[model samples]
Target: MEKNFTIASLEFCLSQLKRADESVVRKAITSGDGLSESSDDVGQKLSEAHKNAVKQCLTNADKLATLHNQIDACDKVFERLQNMLCSFQNNLGTIGEDMKQLQVQSLDIHQELENRQKVRNELSQFVDDIVVPQPMITTIMDADPNERGFIEALHELHHKINLISSRGNGEAVAVNDTIPILENLKYKAIEKVREWLLLKIYQFRKPLSNYQIFQHQLLKCRFFYEFVLNHEPAIARELQDEYIDTISKMFFTYFKAYASRLFKLTMKDAASKEDSVGAIDTAKSSGISGFFAAKPQVRNRATVFSIGQRNGVLQSDFLGALIVPHAAAQNNQSFQFETLFRSLQLAFVDHYSHEYLFITDFFLVSENEALEIHSKAMARAVSVLLKCCEEQIVVNWDAISLHLCICLCDKFQQLLIEREVPDVNGYWETMSNILWTRFDQVMTNHNDSVRMIDLKKLQNQGALDARPHFIVRRYAELTSAHLTIAKSNGKEIGPKVGALLESSEDAIEQLLTRMSTMQTSHKNKHVFLINNYDLILGVIDDNESKQSRIYAIVHELEQKSIDDFVEVVLDPHIGFLIKFVTECEGLINQGHTQLLVRYNDKISTVITTFNQKWKQSIDAIHSEVMNLFTNFRLGTSILQTIFTKFVQYVQRFSKIIAHEVFSSNSACSEMINVHQIMLEIKKYKPVY
Candidate 1:
């Protein structure tokens, strides 16, 4: 607009100037100014001024014409700006409409999410209430106001459900019950919806992940743990196995997803550099490699066997492998060993620790469970805690589980003895006998004096060292506890006690003679003399010759160095474990001094290792310890009761032992209250 105005003003001014110039010319001519004589100079000056004025007017007009043309170009710019303003206004209106639609969509999505969550929550409660119960039975239980033993009620409900389903009306009607039956129905419905969502997610994820039906298997595992295994632990081992099988299969699916995601990222990165092998190498370096590399060593899914025989052997092997390495390693290098020990330790927990946790729950679980208390009143609660490795996120790869085995073994074994739990290990007699023979060997070893043999000379002389023998002696001075004769009301007997108690004299004699006769050509065989607990060993001069028969003996039995893990191995270093198991068997068979102290010695040995090198076994007291060792087992919540009792037992026993051992005066008190000791232990409960 400004440019247009300026141009118009310029044109007007120039036109006025042209008119004025013309008037000047007319005045000059019309006023009759002479072109001759004295006026000739004035006429010539007028003509020149006229020409100059004409030129000035023409220049002004020409410039005005150019300015008008520039003004025309300004119109184009003005039109473009007007169109831009209109487009911006239109876009703003569209955006406003879009915002309203988005708000509506957001509200709808929120409502949908709320509905689903409500369904999931209500159903979860319903499902929890009747997790092990049937619907009809739950109704019957609920029919009564008393809320006890919903277990049976649940069973009854299941039967009813079966009956209804059998009649082909499975989906027809809802059966309400005492224990949140309608809520349970909604719970199931919510489950259906969740399943649908999960399926959708699966569909979306499948092409990218190649993962199939894995979550379903996880659900099945959850079921087996919650329902079948929780109810019956004899089957727990078997069911857990099935769960692990499913887990292993599912892990592969998870691996594929993880592997593919990682690979795609790497491949994309490498595409610019054209490095395909680099991508593959990166994939292999991830967690999937560890899994695959360990695959070749995977046994046909290890299962639980009796711990009595097998544990001793395994302990021996592990100790043998560990001791030398442990002794040589630097203090800070413990973490490396911890990593190596993790798999075995976990394996130990999976087998033994959990079983004991379930069975001994009475002594383990706390009464005032804070989680339960807080959750009871609130509208919502975070049900349990992160207790085990599976539950935790930042699990250290070097977390050695061996300590878990040690923890369970120590408490449970001592508890069994203190409580006089009978026949716990199942091979009490056999184990006692084995224990006795080792003890006998130890006793004999202490008493005998034998000269050392020369292994070097025998070998160099081109003669197979013919012999070395473990000596045995018969002592008739031992009267073997014969009973005195006694009389009953009407009858007299030769002896009051039964004669079945007599030792097999012939067998004992022959055994001693045979052991004594098998002497080696070399003088000393590290002869061990025995007399009850008294031990006296013969110090041999040639130490290397003393164990000449060790290789042959161990080889024949396949007993040393190599692992015999079916019943478990007896590593040469902890070969004393063989003696331990043997002595335990011997003691049980003979009913010698109640239980085997020899086996107890073995336990003490393990304890010594633990005390000395606990840090070497990386499993630490968990950073966030919930209920102390409450999550003793990872399998299930099935054994909550027995485990609770065990905790109580340990508390009591430790206090009593401490009191007796530490105070000379307190030791005199006999027949004191075990419960009293427990009460004292209650004082030690952590303030957490």
Candidate 2:
């Protein structure tokens, strides 16, 4: 078959070569004819050769067909032999795989028998060794046996029982016979172990355990129950309950002992009987003093935990862990931490009240001392409030702020009423300044937060909610407290609020200066200053009572500040625009022959300059003011004011030109075309 295929391939190649050689010979003959300029005889010879080649191809085709049929017969036999060989090889591979599988089966059977025998031996050994040591039982019988020694022996027996049962190889049935014996030993040891555990609990010392005896011992006791009485559920429950009850007693004992110690360390004797009685009398007489008074409380015996000498007791990790399992298993919510928190709060108020009273009494000896105390107290209070806000504590921030402000007011007023305060104006001024500083801080912080917010994102979502403003809740509280103090003292907040207003003016001026320094192509500084002044005015306006004297003073101050700011900062730009228009009007009044053309060329430059400066200012003012204020609306009144004067100048110039035109020759004057001049002037009109 191989030889036949080679011969057929050679024959096909030879036929193709012969055709290629004939084609080359014909091409050569045509080239020769063209070169020689041959006639019809050469063409006849070429036609004859083509006819002969066609006949030869027909003969070759018939021969190739015969050869192809013979090669096909040999190929069939070759293919049959190849198929037979493949089948034989496949059969051999199948037989080899069967033998390998049979070997594996035989090995598995042998391993199974061996494993069975080994398991039987292990089971026999487990059955034989399934008994506790006799000495451990004897030790339980002994009067003063080693407690730890007995525990170790029982642990060994428990370990062995677990090891054997966990095999699940039918050796667990062997332990059925050992259960009664183990139970009997456990029953005998229970009383002794309970007594020993109770003794250990009672003997625990606070200094050594750090009040965590119960937590430290719980794990050991749990392990003991799990190992010793694991098979006896009822007995385990009874023992655990007893252990917990004993723990409860120990907990109380430790708590009480610690409480007593703390009370001894903290308690102080009354320095004078008269002072003590006077303090009580003052608390009762003065409404403000009661807030600072230390009061007694009757304990609630029903509460499992109560506020006492230290907060650490209630916050102990052991107590929390101990209560978790109980809380989880309870049918009802019996635990109420809020009650404990409340108790602690009341007790804390009392404790701190006394401490605060004592400290203030020392400072109250002199006016200077009192002022010092007042400064330090207010500073600390503001610091703590800011810290609480930063930490995001869940507290009534507004209420606490109000209470603190009220307390400050009361403290100052009481001192004044008693005629003990020195430098009355100094006291109130210092307070007003402190409060203003705090207000400024709050506003600054709020502004920073507002700046970070995604304003564009919020606007796009249509969730602007009127553009939320920075909250100044404490500002209201502090102001109200200030007014209340002022009213009680029969004083006015003219100087106090006047000081704050000055501070506000300085801050606005600084901001405007900064915007100018940046040299941005925006004109919003004036607007920003205006809006900030307006916001400050709004605060006063929001709380102002027309009938009140302080409100009147504040209103007057705010109005004056706004008017002054506008004149000093904003009027210059408006005046410049006015001057430029006045100069243009003067040129128009002269009415030269080519006056309008010259004016258009000159004023175009002026208008460009004016718009650049004006637009820059406007942009700066708008951007900064919007950042400071919420839902701000601006008017084109400034633009209108600027343009109105220019409109007057243009109208007056037009009227003069019209009069001149009408007075001249009617035919020649019509050709002047004044409307073109008006259109050129209109090109310089301000879009703003």
Candidate 3:
């Protein structure tokens, strides 16, 4: 019945329900017996009441049906919900067990964290204890902290600090917390080392006052530098400067006292040596040879503190010994030594204006008023100084040589140049000679070992490529300056240049001739003479190109030299033959017909003698001549020219005596005689 509750079926059910209610109302009205006043009214009221009761009963039944249907739907929904809740209950039990396990794990983690914290705290304490094993104050307070023990303690401290740092980012927070403490320890350790070093220096006792304390202080400084400062060069430099300052004060005091003592001792030794020399002179007056001979004397190192002490304490003196020669030595040690000595040199100049240091004396000419009066001592001193500057190591060449040159020139000006009756010619000549000598030495031997300065090397390495030519140009400048000065003074420079050229030519001629004579080769001797003579001629020809009077003289010299060489070499052979022909012509002109017959024999002998000598000379230089002249045609041309002259001379003689001296009718006449000599000459068959 309840399944018929669709919209159409419910409308039909509601229609039937309304009809039943109307039927019950009508029955109730019809059956009603008692009516209160009016029967119809009473019946109508009773009918209404019956209809109400019936409607109430019908409404209750409909409501009961709807409630029963709703209760059954609710029962099915509750049954499905109970099945779903059963799975949830099982899951909840499992979740509750998991929650219990999580609580137990939380407790275990909390306990482990506490244990780790305890371990970390213990480690922190241990690190703190190990980072500084010995109290720094104790070490600082000690009079002399054992260096080994102190270093070990510091090593341990640094090691522990490094270990803590090595814990890395995990312990970065911890390490940062401990950094200040570690830095404080390092600071205290460095301070202690400094204090200890100072104490050792203060306690240093040296009876013999010398540079020995400086060496001791250096050792301590190195210790402070490497051990305390480590790689902190800034701190090390500060300490080093302080130490050097203290030592410099000490050194100056000792140096002044030592200098004073050395001066007195040197004066005493000089006096005693003079007395000893006088005694030796008296003892050795045996002969002139003995008197002139040099005496061999032993030098006492202690007595001699002045110059020439090349092997004594003065050689490795305290001031000089302080210098250490190396790349870095220039900065600290060498700088200090230079500063000290520079001050000393200045002070010496102030105190001893007249007295010169040995090096200064060697380089600078002394102010001698007597040199104008022809004093021998001043000349000897000048010679000695020149020799010393050249040979001794006491003078620095680069620094002192320039000063020495200026001093020499100034002294020359004073004594010779500025004189009232100065020998201007002699002065200019001497100065010019000096310039020439200097130039010649350098030009000839600029590459020799004695030249310590290598301009070629300098040019190769220097920034400017022209550095090597500077010295060469400097010589030219000096020469020009001297020449100009001489010209201004109206001195006779022409004679000097002429003399130099003559001397040079003489030297060249002597050398070439000597070389020619010394040539032992039998063949090509003339060729060898030609090669040597030509080489010299080429040099003189080059010199001639320079438009100077000197070169002009050399050009004249060159011509004379060549003419002389050619005469010496070539004349002996052909000159004699030419002379023979000329003499024969002279005889013909004088009407010596008898002599013409004998002339063939005499001329033949002369030609034979000249040919032998000429052949010998040619043999001497044959190989050299062949090597020297690369052009065979040129050599042939030269030979042709020489022999053609001889041929022409012979031909001229033939023409002169042809018709007069010989005829076909004459038996054993001069023409037949001359023909025999000509045949002998033709046998030579000169190739050129």
Candidate 4:
């Protein structure tokens, strides 16, 4: 019962005691015989235990009350927390609704901003595209055309007008309203440009005015023409017509005066009828007395095709000198026909090339329009120059000079092409036509001159002699010159050249026949014919292309003449020898051995006569040939041919002498042999 066993242990002891029966306790007490330490001690222990048990129960009850009070306070605290959590959940729900509403408001605000931005952009574009600034209008109305601001302003106005015209609609009423203002400004600008351009163009009409400078100035503002053309085509047409008229008239007057003054400086001694190839001076008397008459002493005349002396006419320095009045006067010189033609053409080419470029650049026209404009501008000047050329070509009898003029025209045309000048209007083509026409006419004139030659007049004038006729030499030179020109120009002059050659050949044949009539004998006639033909051949021998048709023809004629002359001259030297050989061969061929035997007696005689006289015959023939033939080579050639014929004749006769029919005569076998004859002919040949 001490400190180790408190009220709860006491209660445990009392509960155990109570659980014991009272009868057991009484019995145990009454049966003292079995009882140990008495019932009194047991009672006291139970009593103390019971008091302790009760005190513990009262303390346990107070502790239970305190635990119950603490449990109720926790219940109150948990209830208050639960109410606060409910309030928080309700606030959270409210906030979720508020956030959804704010999100919607923000999206609406952003959508509003995007719509406002689109509207602002559309407004800005409309304003920029349709607005025409006051500064631009002022520039178009009053600004100087030379100022850069004016062109810029005009460009802006044109753009705005184009935009309005292209996009005019119900929504673009503002843009359409600007059309009148832009049109007024456009007209004003065009008027200003037109006045300025017309002033510059009018200045070209002034004498000694620097039109090139003005043209250069106009080129800077060439865009003005394009603008006017686009806005008002009628006004553009007027300007173009005015420019063409003014410039064309100026060129006409300028070229007309220049050509007139230039024509005076042409050489007065140009080729004439007298210088013609077939010209004959009928006034002169024939000085010849016989067929072998000496050729008249001819003056030293310039060769027909020798144009080197006339090259000064094509010199650039000479062209420049002739253009200047002072220089031309100081030189006091006359130019050839080609020089005059070249100068005038060169001037035209320069003017044309410059004017063509200027018109195309300044007008901004198409190529066809530019060409038309150029043709109109140059029409008057071209007509005058071409007329002058035609008249000069008609009168001038120098075909060589005319040919040179044609070459000059071709060269100038090439130069124009190189300068990129278009020939759509046929200016060069027309010029070439005129030149070729005149050239062919001149050629025809020459041909006609040859065809119309008077043989009687030529013979009476002593123009025909041992030498080649002047006409033949001139014809050869002209043919050669024409061939050279054809080759150089890459043109086909064959038909014309052939006609000329045929005419000349006919004339030469006629002339030779007439001269042959004057010969006293057949041999002399052949000699005269041979001499003239040989001379003609020699004249054309220097031609590089020996394949020329004329060369072949003349060569053939010469050969025929030589053959005739050789037969005529050689027949006398060995006529009987050839006849004897022929007669014996005929008798042998006819199977007449007896007749061949009879001819053998005449064979030695014929051989002896030929041997004794062949040298004298050769010497006489040589002397005659040297005296008659003008070409010494031809004379020697003839002599050699005669000597060869003489040898052949003697060899034939010697062979006839050695024939079996004449073998009975020992003297025939011992006669001079062909070897001895060759030895004798060797002495006559020239050493060279």
Candidate 5:
């Protein structure tokens, strides 16, 4: 087939070459006729040659057709052979693949069989190790011995039954059918073993063979006795004397935990002579106190302490009292009391949730237990509370301290009310007095330090940031607490403490007012320390109230402090205030307009004064640009005085000017045209 394909390829190549040869002869005959006088004769000869060539081509065509036929035959054979070879190879490949799959399948089956055999062997070996009927309790009414092989055979059958049952394979139906027979065998074997053990147990009682001794020994194993007694408790009683009864009871308790059957068993059903009181007594005497002691807070926690309060103290006494407790506690000579106070505060938070701080509940507590709980819990938990507050709970010094104090006072009042605390001539008076005295001392100390205001330092800082912020926050919360009491609704808040609340509130207000005055005085003193210091003090001394007295000193001192060339102290306070006024353009315009309208005639007078005093500054008659921006602030102020002036300016500038009657006029507007345009301008201020 390969040789035939080669012959066909050669024949095809030769036929193509023959066609090329014929074309060359026909081309030569046609071109010579067009080129010469003898071209006609030359063409005739060429034509004859062409004819000859054509005759040759006829012969070549016959050969070509024959070759084509031959090549077709060869191609047909080659194609058939290729088809056969391909079919044969495809069959071989399929057979090879099938054989490979069969080999893999066979290997898998073989491995599966090997695993099965191995599992079976392991199972058989496991069966061989079984000891037949299990080690057991002594039995008493038979005389026989079980053969070792027979016993082992029964054990092996039991194990096989178990294995077959566990797997639950439908293919193991044969094994399933045999389970009843296997179980029967097991029962027979157990019966036989029982008879044998009974024989051994009785036969060896004289000298006590190993079996008899083993029965006695088995009683000592808690589990062995437990097992035997569980199956036959009445039977166990028949074997029992005093010691056996004790062992049997212990066994029952063990079985209660382990088997969970016959649990909480009792001989009380037999109606014992002893009473149950002794048992109750034993239970009560068990070490429960020590267990409670391990957890002091569980025992000690309570909601007990409380107070009564009132408020005519808003903005003053209320504020002071709020601060006094915390301030005094922080400054206390006894760390213990301070710490206890802190702890109670934290306890109130935890026990009551955050609701306690904002709400007043009756807070009913049990007995003195509540009081004692509070006392001890506070003691136990205070140091920890403070420590946690220090590490993880930072508060705003002023805001929180103040808020917390008010909350504390509120909680204390709630406690008092719940406890039905009595007023007048009693423990309440003593406690109140004690608290007041301590508060007074703390306030006195705080004022002494606070009164020596450092105005120079304050001047270096802004109002809100002038001091450690807590001082202000605490001051505010305390003041607010008294305010809260006065505003409180309902009859819960007591009236007895009303005066005290008012006094505290007044004190807080006075203190703040006093501090403000002193700071003002100090600022005055500092500003004029270079000169007239005595004069400044004298001026401040004339004013009674703090701020007034201090401001009197400051004003004079500031005026006197200016340098010779400067007409003012050159302080930048006004500059900042002015900037504040100007930053918002609409606001500036609004303010200027409002102020101008307020002092309409006054502003005109002031402007006139300025114009007269500084002739060069405002010398423009209407010919000039009006120079609105020379004094920027003044110009803004002027806009306020007469908003229409701006309208006129823009109206005048925005018009078309006419310099002649009949000629093209200037583009800019004439003054009369400006007046006309002014009427059209929107005069209303735009909404921001």
Candidate 6:
């Protein structure tokens, strides 16, 4: 029943209750029966209301049945919807699981694609870096040697070889498989380059071949040498040795022939025993008193030392253009000894420089190894040059010519250094030692000759001249030449210079001694000493700093000679005045004023004698000085010096007479004044 009570049944019950109330109210109003007879009346009214209420209940029952049917229909529909929702939830869970699986699979596919692409790229790169193509093999095997294609192929082949040799890729089977093939190709390439280089090297042996042009050609293919050296060092060594041997022998043979022919053109009479510095001879054949009394018109040929005349020889380039013509002409024409020596040295230097550059440029070698190679290649050639130089040095007795040869070596060595040639110092130094040793021997011979000179014979052979002796003049010129060479070369004067000077001094001393024995007068001995000493000093004046030792000695000797000359000339004329003044000064210095006073008459008489003889004394001194010194200027210089000393002595004597001996102005009146004496001396000053 509660289930049947729908909204329609509850509304029907409410309508029945409202209708009963309405009927009761109508009955009370229409009958006006106040309920005074209400017991029976009310019972009948209640029975009628009950009948209406029953009918309305039956109608409500029908509506409530219909509403219950609709409710049952809604309940069935809701249950079906709930079952459908549960099935859908289960289906959605399965779909979500499938979607998650699909997402994971998609991610795996993306990763696999990326890894495959990476592997493909790596494989492509590996093949590109490792594979050798057929074109490369063909090019290496059969291309022209001079073509760019062969070099490119060779580079590619070497790259593959390096990959096989490298630590990281050496164990790869693919890389290992190609090694044997690459090795054969490399060997074939090496042989091709080796044959080419050997052919070029052999061309140097051809006569009249231009080696510098050949060297330039080799330099263009220098990479071939590097290739051979890297692949097979033994083959490279063999090539280098072959080049050294071929070049050495070629240079040796060429230079030997060249030098032999060149030496024949040298002057046979370039130097003689008469050209020696210590060879002293008189000028008697020329009707002169001293050896150098008459200066030769051709001064270059006459002098014992005259390097200035051979400046062309010193500065010669000795080029093949100049040498070859002279060698081929084979005329009777000849050069000086120094000219020959310089030509040989310069030619050798030019060849050595070229050879050094070639060895270093074309060979793949260490610096020391390159030097060793160069030395070996030039060894025989160097021996030829040294041997030629040795013969020249040993056979030649001309000291100046030998010295010039030494200078040539120095100059050539410096030229090589300037040209950036490799070290060939051993050769130059060896040649220099040979030259200097021979020079030393020649100089020693000269010194010994001077020391062992026959003074008596020399005296008997020649008359004494006012000029320097010929031997002294020759010694002076030789010493001057030595100093000039030393100074120009920026070197110190050697010990031999000192020995030469000592020997020269001995010679001059002997000369003066001979002159003293020949002359009876003290004046002639002083004159001879002065002339020789002055000549030496004048000749070496340009090299004073380098020849300070010799310069100082000669200077001192010259001053002593002048002093002796002045004493001998002046003593006879004014000895009394000088002695008197000297004695009076001494007495005055000793507090002997009384002794000086007693000598007043003597002083007056001395003044009278000086006043009478001063002019004659100066004139006589001038005549004697002019007679003694061959050089007029030298005579004037000595005369001026004598006058200066005489004036000074006169000044002292006049002061002594005035202050010490003569007490009165009248007594001082007779004294000679210094100005008057200087005025008289000024008449004799030299013009030039």
Per TM-score, the best of the predicted structures is 6
- Give candidate 3's error at residue 48 in angstroms: 71
Decreasing lDDT order of the candidates: 6, 4, 2, 3, 5, 1
TM-score of 6: 0.75
CA shift of 417, model 3, Å: 48
Point out where model 3 deviates above 4 Å.
1-140, 152-195, 202-242, 246-567, 575-688
lDDT of 3 at 432: 33
lDDT, residue 50, model 6: 96
Q: What TM-score does each of the candidates earn? A: 0.18, 0.28, 0.28, 0.68, 0.20, 0.75
lDDT of 4 by residue, 1-688 (tens): 5766688877985686688798976686687754346546777898999999988988799888899999999999999999999999999999999999999999999999999999999889778878878999888888898899988887787677777677765566786677777888888888998997898899999997777898898888787887888888999999999999999899998888788878788876677656666665433335455445455444333544445445444344323533754468579978777777777887888888899999999888889988889999999988888777777777777777777676666677677788999853666677777777876776666666766777677767776556556676676676566555544554555565566566657766775776677766888777777776776666655544356677688778878887788777777877777778788878878988886766756766776777677668767777877888777788888778767776776677776676777778766654556676667667767777
Clashing pairs in 4: none
Model 6, 509-554: lDDT tens digits are 6656666556547777788889888888777777454346878877
Please list the residue runs of candidate 1 whose C-alpha ends up more than 4 Å from where it truly belongs after superposition: 1-57, 113-173, 176-688
Alpha-carbon lDDT of model 1: 0.33
The C-alpha lDDT values of all candidates are 0.33, 0.43, 0.43, 0.74, 0.36, 0.76
lDDT tens string, model 5, 181-209? Answer: 55555455445544433343344333313
Q: Which candidate ranks first by lDDT, i.e. highest?
A: 6
Q: Give the Cα error of residue 637 in candidate 1, in Å.
A: 76
Report the Cα RMSD per candidate. 37.0, 29.5, 24.3, 15.5, 30.2, 13.4
Candidate 3 lDDT tens digits, 1-688: 5666677777975686587678755775587744334448756998999999999978799888899999999999999999899989999999999999999999999999999999999888756744444454355335244455566566655566566656653455556666666667667767776665555444423445443444445353443445455534566555544543444344344434433332222122221322210011123335677667665343442221111221121112322322223323334222221122323322322222221221122212234421232222123323332333233212221111221232233333443333332332233244334444543343223222212343234334341221112222222222233233233333434554435334434443443344344344423334444443343333323222344553454446434543443444345556665676777778877988777765644544554565455445444333333344554643443444444454466566556545444433232233234444345445444454
lDDT of 1 at 260: 28
- Over 562-582, each residue of candidate 1 has an lDDT whose tens digit, in order, gives 112211211222234334445
Could you tell which candidate, 1 or 2, scores higher by lDDT? 2
> Pairing residues by index, what is the TM-score of model 2?
0.28
